[model samples]
Target: MAKYDYDLFVIGAGSGGVRAARLAAMAGAKVLVAEEHRVGGTCVIRGCVPKKFMVYASEYAHHFKMAEGYGWTVGESSFDWPRFIAEKDKEIARLSGIYVRNLQNAGAELVHGRATLLDAHTVEVAGRGRVTADKILVAPGARPWMPVELPGIEHAITSNEAFHLEELPKRIVIAGGGYIALEFAGIFNGLGVETTLVHRGPNVLRGFDDDIRAHIAEEMDKRGIKVILGAQHAAIEKTDTGLVSRFTDGHHCESDVVMFALGRAPYVDGLGLEAAGVELDEDGAVRVDDYSRTNVENIWAVGDVTNRINLTPVAIREGHAFADTEFNNKPTTFDHDMVASAVFSQPPIGSVGLSEAEARHRLGKVDVYLARFRPMKYALTGYSERCLVKLVVEAATEKVVGCHVVGPDAPEIIQLAAVAMKMGVTKTQWDSTCAVHPTLAEELVTLREKYVPQGLGQAA
Candidate 1:
C-alpha cells in the first residue's frame, strides 16, 4: 500500500475539482485541491456564468426597444459596455471568494499554484512545492481552440477576451461552427453589432440535430446576422481601418473585430500527464474509463480534460461521482446519456438523449416527432421568433431517445424534459398528458401527437 500525504489530490479547481474536493472532504478524507488560477475555473470565470451575463446584457437592447409596446414612453436607448464589464468582474470576484470559503469550510486544503505530476502517486505545485496522495483527480478543463496559422492572427480573439471588449464592434466576423460560435454570434448580433457568422460546415452547430441547426440558421438570418455556411476562412490581415478576413471562396469580410467561438481543447499540456502514466485520447483529451479512472491506477480525471461531455453540469456530476466512488467506496458511475444540456443562443436551445440523425444512424428505424410555431410572448412583442420541439425514439421499443427545443427559456425548460427522459417516459406517455397553456413547453406534448405513437418499428 502506498502511504500518501492526502487521501485525495485534486488538480484544476474548476467545477469538477471543487465539487470533488468538497465531497471528498465531507467524506472525512484529507483533500488538497490545487488550482493554478481561480477557484471557480472556466464556467464561473469565463465559460458559463460570465458569458451568460454578456448574453443577458446583449439582450437588453431588444427589451429596451420593445418597451414602447408596454405603454412606456422611451426616448432613446443606449448600452454601457464598461459598466456591464465592471459588474461582471465584481460578480466573478465575489463568486471566486465563495468558492474559496467553501473549500476551507469543508476542511480541504486549497493550493494556489500550477500542478505537475512528479510521479504516479505524487504531484508538485509550483511555488507551493510537492504533495502526494492516495488518489489524484485531474479536472483541468478546456480552452478555446483557435486555429494555428493566419497572417494577422494576433488580431483574432477567443471567448476568453470576448466578454471584456471595450465597446461592441460595428462589424464583427465570427469564425467556427460550434455552439460557442453560435452563442457568440447571437450575443454580437443582439447587441446591434453587424455580425457575420462564417461557418466551415453547412450548419452552425455540428453535434446538434439537423433541424435544430437549420432552424437556428434561419432565425440568425432573421436577426440580421449574415450566415455564410460551407465557407472557410483562409487568412486574416489588418487594413488601415479594421481587421479583414479572406475566405477560401474568394470573398473577403472586413470587421472591427474577429472572434473565434471555434471550439475548445483539453487544457492538459503542462500537467505532466505523460510522467504520471495517464493516457490521452485521439484529440488529446485525457482518456478515462466510465468510472473516471485513468491509466494510472490511483489517478482519475473528469470534465473537459476527459472530453466525455463538454457541459458544466456533466463535469460537476462526473467529479462528484468520482469522489463518491473513490473516497467513499460508493461504486457510483457516470452515465453520459443521462446528461442533459442547453445552449444560450438568442433563442436558447436544449436537448436530452439521442439526436434524430443519431437515432436513425444507430437504429434501423427511429421515430421522429417535431413541432414548430411562434410563441405567445412573441405575438405581444411583434417578434416572429419561433420554437421547435423534436423527439427521437427507438422504432422497436418506443423509448424516448431524445428531446430537443429551440426558443426562449430553453435551458429552464430542458431540465423537466431531462427528468422525464430519465424515467423512460415514451411518446404515449407525453401525448396522454396535459400542457400548460400558452407556454413554450406545451410544444413537447404537442410534438408527441405527430410521432404516430405506435411503438417503434411497428407495422401500420
Candidate 2:
C-alpha cells in the first residue's frame, strides 16, 4: 500500500514547482500541486513575460525617430497605454492556463489554495485540512522589496503595481540600481514619460562589467533619462500635485509616481517551515544543498525560494533536476556555472560567465577584448546609439571566461556567445571565424585589441 496520499506534494505552482510536479507525476509518482496565486508564478504572471512586452511597447518612440533618419516620413503617433495593458493581461491569462493544463495533462492534481507544511511529510491546505505526502517541494519564489523606513513610503509603488497604474505618469522617479530599476527606467523613458533614475550607488548595474555599467549610464543620459547616482530617496510624500520625493542629498523632485525596484526577498512567510524543521538562511531564503535538498529528508526547494541564481530558467532547470534525481534515480544537478542572462533595459544587456572584475580576482590576470562603435543602421540615420561587445579571457588558459554586450539586440547576440563560452571557446577560435558582413555581431570576431590600461585605448 502507498505510505501517503501523495508520493509528492508541491507548494507554490510557480515555474519550478509546476515543472517538478509534472515531471514527478509523469514518472509515475502521484503528485499534487497547491497554489495560492496563478499557476505561472512570477516569470509568467508578473515578471519577465509581461516586462518584456512592456519593453517592446516602449521602443516604438525610438523606432519612429530612427525612421526619420532613414529618410522615411513618419506621421504623428500616440500610444494607448490602456490597450497595451489589456493585451498584456490577456496574454498572461493564456500562459497561466497552459501551465495549469500541462500539470493536469501530466497527471498531477492541482489544488487551488495556500499550503503550509504541517510536518516533514504533511501539508495543510489553508481551509482545506491536511494531506499526507512522502515528499514535498517548496518553490514559492520571491516578492518585490521596498524600504518602509521612510514616511509615506506606502505611497510608492513596486513593480507589481506599475502594471496596473491608471495612467502613464508624466514624470516618474525610480529607485535602485538593479535590473528591475534599469528596465523600467528605459520603459517609461522610451514611452515618453519624463523619467529620473535615482540610485544609491556610484553607478547602476553594480555587479556588471565596469565598462558596460558606464556605457549604459551614458546611453540612458543621452536618451534624456536623468540618471541620479550615489543618493537615495529620503521620503515619499503625497502632495496636491502628484508626489514629491525628497532625496538624502537635500535635493527633491516631484513626479506623478515613485517606483521602487530595490530587489526581491524570498517568499516563505506562513509556510509553517519551522514546524517541518525546514531551515532558512539569514536572508530568509529556504536553505538547500547542492541538490536542492532541505534539512528535512522529505523536504526540498528550488528557484528563488532557495535564493540560488534567481533567474526563471535557472529555477526551471533546478526543478527538472530535482525530479530526475528523486524520481528517475538519475542524480542530476543543474550546472549553475556559465548560465547566461539578459537585462531588458533600454539598450538591453546580454551577459554570460564571469565579469572582468571577477576574472581578474580569480585568475590573477586576464586579457580583455572590447569593441564599441555606432551600429551600421545608425550611420545614415545619424543615430549616436553605440554598441559594445567585450570578451574576458583567462590569461593562463586562453579560455573565454565572459561575454558582455550592450545596445541593439544585445540579448540575442549574447545568447549565442554564451554557448561558445560554455564550450570553452578560446580567443583563437573567435579570431579564425569569418565576420558576418557589416553586422554589429561581426565585431565579436573582429575585435583584435586588448583593452588599454588607461581610458578606452586599444592594444597595438
Candidate 3:
C-alpha cells in the first residue's frame, strides 16, 4: 500500500505550482494540484496578460496622433469598454483552459477548491476531504493590497477590479508610485480619461534609475497625466459627481474611479500555514531556502508567496528548479540576479540588473553611459517623445552591471541586453557589437561619451 495519497500535492496552480506539478508528474511522481480560484493565477487571468491587452488597446490613441503627424489621414476612432472586456475575458478563459489541459497532459490530477495545509504532509480541500502526500508545494501567489483603515476605502478598487469595470470612467485617481499605478495611469489617460496619479513618494518609479524616474515623470505630465507627488489618500467618499479622493494635505479630487495600486501582499491569510508549521517572514511571505524548501522538510514553496523576485518568469524557474531537485535527482537553484523586467506604461520601460545608484553604492566608482534622442519613428511625426538608453559599468572590473531604457521597444531591447549581462559581458564587448541601422536599439551600441551629471565630477 502507498504511504500517502500522492507523491506530491501542489497548492495553488499558478505559474510556479503548475510548472512544478507538470514536471514532477512527468518524472513519474504522483502529483495533484488544487486551486481555489482560476488555474491561470494572477499573470494569466487578472495581472499581466489582461493588463497588457489593455495597454495595447489604450495605445491606439497615440497611434492615431502619430498617423496624422506622418501625413496619413485617420478616421474617427472609439473604444467600447464592454467589447474590449468581453474579448479580454474570452481570451483569458482560453488561456486558463490551456493551463488545465497542460497539467492533465502531463499526468497531473487537479481539483477545483481551496486547499489548506492541515499538517506538514496533509492538505484539506474545500469540497474534498483531506489528502496526504509525501511532499507538498505551496505557490498561492499574492493579492493587491488596500489600506482598510482609510475611510471609505471600499469605494476604491485595485488593478484586479479595474480589469472588470463595466463602464469606462471619465476620470481616474490612481494612488501609488509603483509600476502598477503608473501603468494604469497611462492606460486611463491614453483612453482619454482625465488621469491623476497620487503618490506618497517625491517621485514615481521608486528604485529605478533617478534619470529614468525623472524622465518618465516628465513624459507622463506631457502626456496629460497629473502627477501629484508626496501625497497620500486620507479618505475616499462617494458623491453624486463620482468618487472623491481626499488627500492627506486637505485637498481632494473627484473622479469616476479611484484605484489604490498600493502594491501586493502574499496571499497567506486563512491558508492554515500555522497548522502546517510553515515559517513566514516579517512581511508575511513564506520563508524558504534557496531550494524553496520550507522549515518542514517535506514542504516547499515558490512564486509570489515566497516573495523572492516576484516576477512570473522567476516563479516558473523556481518551480522547475524545485521539481528537478526533488524529482529528477538534480539539485538546482534559480539565479535571481539580472532578471529583465518591463513596464507596459505609455512609451514603456525595460530594465535589467542593478540600478545606477545600486551599482555606485555596491561597486564604488562606476562609469555611466547614457543616450537620449528622439526615435526615428517620431522624427517625421514631429513628436517630442524621446528614448533613453543607459548603461552602468563597474569601473574596477569594467563589467556592465546595469542597463536601463525608457522609450520605444525598451522591454524587447532590455531582454537581449540581459542575456549579454548574464554572461558577464564587459563594456568593450558590448561596444564591439555593430549598430543596426535605423533602429532605436542602435543607440545602445553607438553611445561613446561617458555621462557625468552636473555637480558630480568624473565617474559617478
lDDT of each: 0.87, 0.91, 0.93
Residue-level lDDT tens digits of model 3 in 348-376: 99999888889988889999999888888
Against the hidden reference, what TM-scores do the models get?
Answer: 0.95, 0.98, 0.99
- Residue 236 lDDT (model 2): 90
> lDDT tens digits, residues 139-246, model 2?
999999978787879899999999888888899999999999999999999999999999999999988998899999999998899999989999898999989999
The residue-level lDDT of candidate 3 at 227 comes to: 94
For model 2, the superposed segments whose C-alpha errors exceed 4 Å read 455-460
Q: Give the TM-score of candidate 2.
A: 0.98
**Alpha-carbon shift of residue 364 in model 1 (angstroms):** 2.2
Q: In angstroms, how far off is 338's CA in candidate 3?
A: 0.7
Q: Positional deviation of 13 in candidate 1, in angstroms?
A: 0.5
State the lDDT at 18 in candidate 3. Answer: 98
Model 1, residue 109: C-alpha shift (Å): 1.1
Can you tell me which runs of candidate 3 are displaced by over 4 Å?
none
Clash number for each model: 2, 0, 0
